[model samples]
Target: MTALRFPALAGLLLVALVGISRPQPVAADTPAPAGFAAFVDDYYAALFAWEPNQATYAGIHDFDEKLADLNAPNITHRADVLKKLHERLKTLRAGKLTADEAIDAETLDHAIRAELLELEVVRDWKRNPVVYLGKPAEGIDMLMKRSFAPPADRLKAVIGRLKAAPQLLGAMKTNVENPPKEFTDLGLIVAKGSVSFFRNDLPAWAKDAAGKDKKLFAEFEAANKPVIEAFEAAAKWIETELLPKSKGKYAIGPDAFVKKLETEEMLDVPLDKLLAIGEANLKRDQETFVATAKKIDPKRTPAEVLATLNEDHPKPEDLVGATRGTIERTRKFLVDKKIVTVPSEVRPTIAETPAFMRTGGFASMDTPGAYETKATEAFYYVTPPETEWEARRKVEHMRQFNKTGMDIITIHEAFPGHYLQFLYAKQYPTKVRKLYTCGTNVEGWAHYAEQMIVEEGYGDGDPKVRLAQLNEALLRDCRYIVGIKLHTEGWTVEQGKKFFVEQGYIEPETAFQEARRGSYNPTYLYYTLGKLQIYKLRDDYKKAKGADFRLQTFHDEFVRQGGLPIKLIRKIMLPGDTGPTL
Candidate 1:
């Protein structure tokens, strides 16, 4: 349910293609058709101008001098821009354009609509500004890791942004002056994490770059001093001014939440229908967990079996080694099983999660975006155990990295999952589909991959592995229910945490962390929901194809179509016109 409020299509477009270069102008072909290319060019120009940070990420240097103004006033201004863009896009006749131009038009049309839908229909910003917590840090992190600029040039940009830190903090204060107490408290947590970017992580990055660019490194350190102070000051403000005002009630309520479900997720099903599906899946997963647990230890109850299994799994001595082992084993399993095709360009490395980008979600895979070429390609970042945590808390935190959980995470983040999906997406022929991949499709596929591999007899014929996979799915299913209920069903945070701990079998601290995450990310439910759709799709496709269907063939075909929405995937696979529309 992570409710990120950034410009949508712009970000997707920036990251759509991995290695594509800027197109060279071709010789005149019927004068490039009337007003079509001009329209597309103008649309992109307006977009980049409005969102310069997006351009920087896209490797388009045309707007490097500017950063987006994400304050409330600018959000309104951007909303107006989106409205106008949508209107203009609607005026263009698709039939009048060439096939390529037509596709571009449709892409622009969808992008424009998606932007407007987010601002006007979703209105997430009005409900919560906690989405801003990791944004500034993400800006810094992306520029450092993903951009094509030289270390000096990149450091220069970092220094420039660092100089603006105080101003940015001031704007943030003004923006959230009347924010919900819950959001403000969350903001403080995020700010504390964000400050680590400057106080701790950046120094290491600066040291790495210092060998090649000493002057830039010096400037970076000097500039970061004020930025670090500003972040600290902001954190203090959250404790004092913001946290006190964070209380009272701030639910979207059932009606608005339902509207959001219908529009934002494009879910046509009613709340009860969705709940029914969730309940059914929950029951099924629990049964599988129980049955599998019985196989491992017949004398124990399901919960007792889980406890016994947790005790039996390997526990690595160090965090890095633990994560590395999980990743390597999962990658090798996929290759050995031939479950999914691995890309030659794949380079899945685990790294410490940067401070600035540490809120809203736990772990994320940063696949190379469309315009990025010759950059550090992919990373699976795991948040380090916080140093300030007490001994018991630290132990609980480390338990999150238990061997089985780490393996499950590796399945989601790397092998036959996100990294693999992105590799095939890079080969997709259509730029529009490639540019705007669906989260449900991408995340769902990974979630499905976790269970698929285990069900297909991975882990050396151990049912415990399958049990672990189901437990992970159970956690996600609980996320779906909790996320919807908390945001729309008037369930309190405590209630949500209770649901996580009681039903999902999650630890107390983990439950609290997940509940807080659901505050802003109501649609985080899509990981499991999407995975369920993919699984159902596979079953239906297999039945339809009868004896001809093969798991590898189905998987290859499914992924090769780009990460289209499952609705569109239905049309692609079933070959019928009555496809579900977003």
Candidate 2:
């Protein structure tokens, strides 16, 4: 039997161990393939040993005794391993492998290539030492706070890693001895938020798991004090030394940005094409917004209507209650319309955004990771209104957080969206398909879901709700334009911010934040780009299926493909001689 090469799978598993064990036999009659299954099993074993915190997150406790080494030597060693694995995969013949084995091999190939690309093409970690230096070496802490593992197990992992916290800090210091100033500045900002993971959240978990593990709390407090000190030192270094020297520019220029776009997203189109798509979507969504605005108030123009919507928005009397009400209403709409079957496993909870994660956005969904067997749940985290703000500023912020906006966010971040899609993804059998999630498909589906549900008349004739939905879509469209323009078209931060305010209809402060974030996160474009790809794929699939193409059936099948790249979606949906072009 030919040796089925799966170095790619090994590479991905190495990053953060998902719940892939041995490759189960294809069926009873078809015996397990020889080399391929062995490759997968061996890869899983190595992964668990190397990254115990990762294993714990995946619900595998065999390696709960150790933690990942974020030290320089370990990072170098892993890079070397990835290089060897990529070479090994290149030597294997895919045609000789079994059908299932071939799929695994293909996935492995993609993963290895991606890792190699990251190492070769991306030099941010090395060039901007502050980026690495500023990061908290508390994967265990993160896993615990995220509730990826049981409280007891998470506590144990935290204690184990805490014992090595000094060494991790030493390694970080060594790595950042000559770090870039920009990295240090950003690192300081991120680090200031770090201690809260232990100071506030860890104690809550300890209280919850009190009777089960008495020693856990003591161990946590003992280990955390030193870790907090080290983080404080790192933060000081970033603020004092790094920020002063941060002469480095954030953008990587057109060529690097294009390569990053392709590498990160596996997108085929150039940056200009992406910008064009964004512009088109912005125009389309704006028209929809205008029409909806007219419905809300025929006398007012779209711009005037938008201003009125903002003017009549609510005060912050009971924020959580208001957001929860929106969620319940959205769930009812999904069920009533029969838009798609929501799995019983879909349960969404509203929570305050963790301080560490608030840098990313005002709200985000914490979907169940691939390895989770528990019912897929999501966290619709709303960042708490700023406490120190004066009454007027506070009220203005509250006005920004209206019921219409919350409903739009709920539809995008929860029901019939990320949580629902994730529940469907859990049903996919292939480890490669399940583990290697496509961000485009994931975010895109949620973005598309927001508009899709709104178009189906979800908000009980409330044009404010519909207007908010279009505004969100427009925000994503602005992201795409700003992302491409900042990186590929040499647009400055000021230009990007202006474009957001003008084209996206976003507030100046929000636009500024969005533009700044785009400099570092080029992948933000995935929201609109992914939606467009899915929409195109659906239209083509519908035409091909002819009379059989029910919307729910199409949505069910599309999501069942397990968040594969849209390029691969066409292959799965239309599997014949003439497949859709990339």
Candidate No. with top TM-score = 1
Runs in model 1 lying further than 4 Å from the true structure: 1-48, 56-66, 93-114, 121-129, 207-218, 248-250, 262-264, 312-317, 360-362, 577-582
In candidate 1 the C-alpha lDDT for residue 301 amounts to 79
Which regions of candidate 2 fall more than 4 Å away from where they truly are?
1-34, 41-54, 62-67, 98-104, 127-153, 176-185, 207-216, 298-301, 311-317, 373-378, 389-400, 577-582
Give model 2's TM-score versus the native structure. 0.85
Question: Which tens-of-lDDT digit does each residue in 1-582 have in candidate 2?
Answer: 000011122111112234354322122233333466555554445555555544544445555445556676766665666655555555554436765556556666656556555555554554454344323443554455455456676667667776665565566566544444434555665676676665667667666754456676777778878877777786776677766766666666777676655654567676666667778888988888888888989998776777666666554546666777877788777778888877664366777766655453666665544555442345567665556657665654565566678777777777777667656765665666655555577778888888888778887668788888887888889988888887767777789899888887777666776887777665678888888878888888889989988888888888777666676667667775254332
**Local distance difference test, each candidate:** 0.66, 0.63
RMSD to the native, candidate 1? 4.5
